[model samples]
Target: DAGITQSPRYKITETGRQVTLMCHQTWSHSYMFWYRQDLGHGLRLIYYSAAADITDKGEVPDGYVVSRSKTENFPLTLESATRSQTSVYFCASSPVAGTEAFFGQGTRLTVV
Candidate 1:
């Protein structure tokens, strides 16, 4: 089974537009996370979910929102896309907190 999956591996959007990225995992892991990677900022956690219906903001959660309605699916939405938000997004899942996480290939989003 596929461990993790992210949709639209690459995307290009205009500024001020709304965009949504989809993530899915097959392991039914207890923890799921959203992260954004940039040159200077490296990778920063955006949001995470401990389990279904449980979510929390991460270090860089201001411009993004995430929800986990089911253990296998976690989707992230960018309310108003910005050039600053242009980066690689990754979805990861782990069986326990602080444990090894399995990540998707990553989605590269470009906001013009």
Candidate 2:
């Protein structure tokens, strides 16, 4: 099937360590977003790219770095993993703004 996929579905890392979560979509959607799902915050956007090479910070972008050099790939990197960063990260893609978005299974990341 053609859809979005996230690598390392589950990851455990130590504090202060840097980790990168990979996300890829086959649809070549125009909008791709990275969101961290936390208990109280629900789904908070970390970063989003409107198109290849066009990126912007969302609600919570601190300690996170995102790049989209290709329409099919959007990778998010944690500069330094922290205990508070432990959450399920989701990658989503939409053909355009205000449209239905398809999400990946998500990557469960834990920081010790």
Candidate 3:
């Protein structure tokens, strides 16, 4: 029963408030990513980490922050929540780039 999991499947926060979506994997995958899923944009990469202490910005990095202190955890934080940031966020981990990845159930965040 070891797999990726996200905390707070759903969350509601006010605009300007800061919110963080946590992701953890028991498999110790080397590649972890944070993506936001919206109506028209589909899945947009927000950030990713190749290894512990190594992170990089992705397609949409503005307004978001991510860090990976451990190989098994990747957390994404919205510095200042906004209505435009309201979307379903997904966390995925892969053994390597360009390979199949395992995803968490996702976190639904509503910024109002």
TM-score of each: 0.96, 0.97, 0.97
List the candidate 1 regions with Cα displacement exceeding 4 Å. Answer: none
Best by lDDT: 2
Candidate 3 residue-wise lDDT at 21:
94
List runs of model 3 lying over 4 Å from the truth: none
Q: Which runs in model 2 stand beyond 4 Å of their true positions?
A: none
Tens digits of per-residue lDDT for model 3, 12-101: 999999999999999989999999999888899999999999999999999999889999999999999999999999999999888988
lDDT of 2: 0.96
Measured with C-alpha atoms, the lDDT of residue 72 in candidate 1 is 96
Q: Model 3 residue 69 lDDT?
A: 90
Kindly indicate the candidate among 2 and 3 with the higher lDDT: 2
lDDT of each: 0.94, 0.96, 0.94
lDDT of 1 by residue, 1-112 (tens): 6789999899999999999999999998999999999988888999999999999999989989888888999999999999999999999999999898999999999999
Candidate 2 residues 1-112, lDDT tens each? Answer: 6999999899999999999999999998999999999987799999999999999999999999999999999999999999999999999999999998899999999999
How many pairs of residues collide in each model?
0, 0, 0
| Model 3 residue 97 distance off true place after TM-score fit, in angstroms | 1.9
